[model samples]
Target: MTPLVSVYIPTRNRSALLRRAIDSVLAQTYPEIEVLICDEASTDDTAEVVADYARRHPGKFTYLRNETPQGACRARNRCIEQAIGTYVTGLDDDDLFHPQRIECLVDIYRRHSPSFACSRFKYFQDPAQIERLREHRYSETELARADKLTLPALLYANLAGNQVLTELSRMRELGGFDESMPSWQDYDMWIRLADRYGTAVCTRQLLSFVDDDRSRARIRNSSRRAEGSERFIAKHARLMNADQKRNHRNIQYVMNRQRPSLGEIARNISLGGYKSTLKVLLHKFFGVAIG
Candidate 1:
């Protein structure tokens, strides 16, 4: 029997954009798949839209709507708990998947037997740009620097992005996303997954689309950042190296909107070096991301 893959989406009040995510998942070339959605107490007509898809696809979809919002972690966990497929992945309500995404991701298991597989996403502010990148979305698949995603390197940054394809059982074992993390929840979860299992590979192909919308950006720039970053460092501190600790300590300046003193700057240079120190300083003053 062909392996089944479950694609889960957790959404809230974006009925207008939700269809693109659903359509992209349903249109996958890999036939044995299920779409599980958990709506986080949306006031909009999100239910009606889900009903329309349920009617069209019948058993192909499973929909869950919470009366009260329990945040993204809980919403995703609810969907994951009910997924019937052996292998699973996630799609943000505003993101998309190329038709060959599933086929390409599952290929990792067939070819390299990796712990997990993810593809780089094409981020766009304008939806129209997606059409231009449609050519050969799955043309290439490489070992995607699995080495960099492990240990000290991963502590420096989140190279894995937000979504990946892996076994549902493994997700359960790792215990899904942490609800307490106000931000960087995906990064935290990936670290746990990497620690539990060995390194995972990624595809260089742009098989996914991420909408860089203002709403998403607003949530990212929220005030709870200090809380989240503090928790992140506390949880992973034991595992971090001297530089990783310094790097995150410097990150705290950005999170708390505090300018580092000359002494602190000197300390950042001790492990993080000048380039990494400058990246944080630029973000603190100009609100720009270096990479």
Candidate 2:
């Protein structure tokens, strides 16, 4: 039997983009899917758009509009709770899934039996002009195979998108996305899920992330990123090893401009040796970029 995949889209005020997202799901090669649209109290015609889809598609579409504007995490959790599918994934309102995305992901799950699976995806600026796609290319070339990700790697960066297809049961057991986080909620969820059951990545570009040109600003917004990273680190600090802690602190320093404590530096040096620790310190104080 085919598995049912639930694609939940948590959106607010992006009705035009939301239609594109919904259409992508509807156009998936995989037939067994339920598209859940969690509207965060959109004042626009989001309701009408969703209602029209419901009328046309019948059972394929599910809609829930919040009375007030809850954040993305809460909206996602609300939709996930109501989803009736064997596996589930999320799609940002501004993104699009390739035609074979669900079909490929579901096949990977069945064949590899991974707890959750993610694939490399491209990031493009504008979909309207297909020629402009070549102008800006953002693709994942790392993890070209199904390798188990380490906490250290994930601690430093979010290697995958929020569109990872995970088993509904596993997600619930791990406790869904951290609702308190204003950002990096997807990264936090990936760490927790990977830490528990291990993570595998498919070396295929099955999704397209429409970079709204907001990522740079979001990255530069040190406070928001730092707060979310701090929360994630605090929650999983006990499980992290010395190297992981050092990397986590390094990220904190880089993003938040918060200097690492003397004790932290000493611990990192003792564990990682002088050369690496010195390099990190130089990057921290001298503004040298750490790759």
Candidate 3:
């Protein structure tokens, strides 16, 4: 029997882009899949677009709307609460999944049986100007072999994408995504999953066309992210090693660097120096290595 996979999307006021995301899921090569769109009180025609899909596709699509604007993590949690599939994955509202993503991810999950499986993805300035890049470069041979996702690696940076496919049972056991965090909620979940079960990267590029638009830019610029980063560190500090702790403290510094404290900078450099600072930056932005 084919295991069902649920693709959940959480959105707020991005009806145009959300349409494309929904269409991408609808076009998936995989058949035994369902789509759950959690609209976070979008003030646009998000509901109408979702209704159209549900009407056309019948049982294949599910839509849940929030009464008021909650954050993306909360919206996803709500979707997870309702999903009936054995496996669950996610897509950002402004991103597109490759046609083979669902099929390939499910196959990998069956083979590895890890807590979750993720793949490499890249960004583009415009959603339409998409192109394949050799940035992540993982071979099928490599992806077939299971590798552990360690706490130190996550402390250095979050190597996994938002596009991870995880077992529904594990997600429910972990209590789903952290709703309090305004950012890095996915990263936090990945770390917790890795610590308890284990995680693997599929190496295949299964997602693409991540739009670097103003909405994402605004969230990145929010002061709430810094607070969230600090909260992540405080919550996970005890699980880290000396080097990981230094790197995490450096991450805290990077998240709130505009107020640049001389003492914090000096402390990070004194502990890790140029190499450590560079690792932190690469982990923060590019997600290079550490996987």
Give me the candidate number with maximum lDDT. 1
lDDT of model 3 at position 125: 73
* Cα lDDT tens digits for candidate 1, 1-291: 889999889999999889988988887888999899999999999999999999999898899988999988899999899998889899989888888888888876556566677777777788878856654444443423223245556677666777888889989988888987887787788778777776777776677887877656544567766677788889988888888888877766655666666677776853533456786778756777653
lDDT of 3 by residue, 1-291 (tens): 998998899998889989888887886778998899888888888899889888999999889988898888888988899999999999889888777667667777787776677766666675545534412344556445544555556666777766688888888999999988877788889988888886554545544456667655555567877777788878888887766777766666555543334565555652433455764556555655331
Model 1, residue 86: distance off in Å is: 1.4
TM-score of 3: 0.84
Q: Give Cα distance to truth, residue 235, candidate 3, Å.
A: 0.8
lDDT per prediction?
0.78, 0.73, 0.74
lDDT for residue 174 in candidate 3, whole number 0-100: 95
lDDT of 2 by residue, 1-291 (tens): 988998889988889989888887887778999988899999999999999999999898889989899888888888898899999999988787776677777776776776577777666655765234323433334223355455555655666766688888777887788888867788878878777886555545434455554544443355777788788778888777777667666666656544576677666653433344665687657766543
Q: Which 10 residues in a row give candidate 1 its minimum summed lDDT?
A: 139-148
With candidate 2 superimposed using the best TM-score fit, by how many Å does residue 184's alpha carbon deviate from the native? 2.0
TM-scores of the candidates are 0.89, 0.80, 0.84
Return whichever of 1 and 2 wins on TM-score: 1
C-alpha-based local distance difference test score of model 3: 0.74
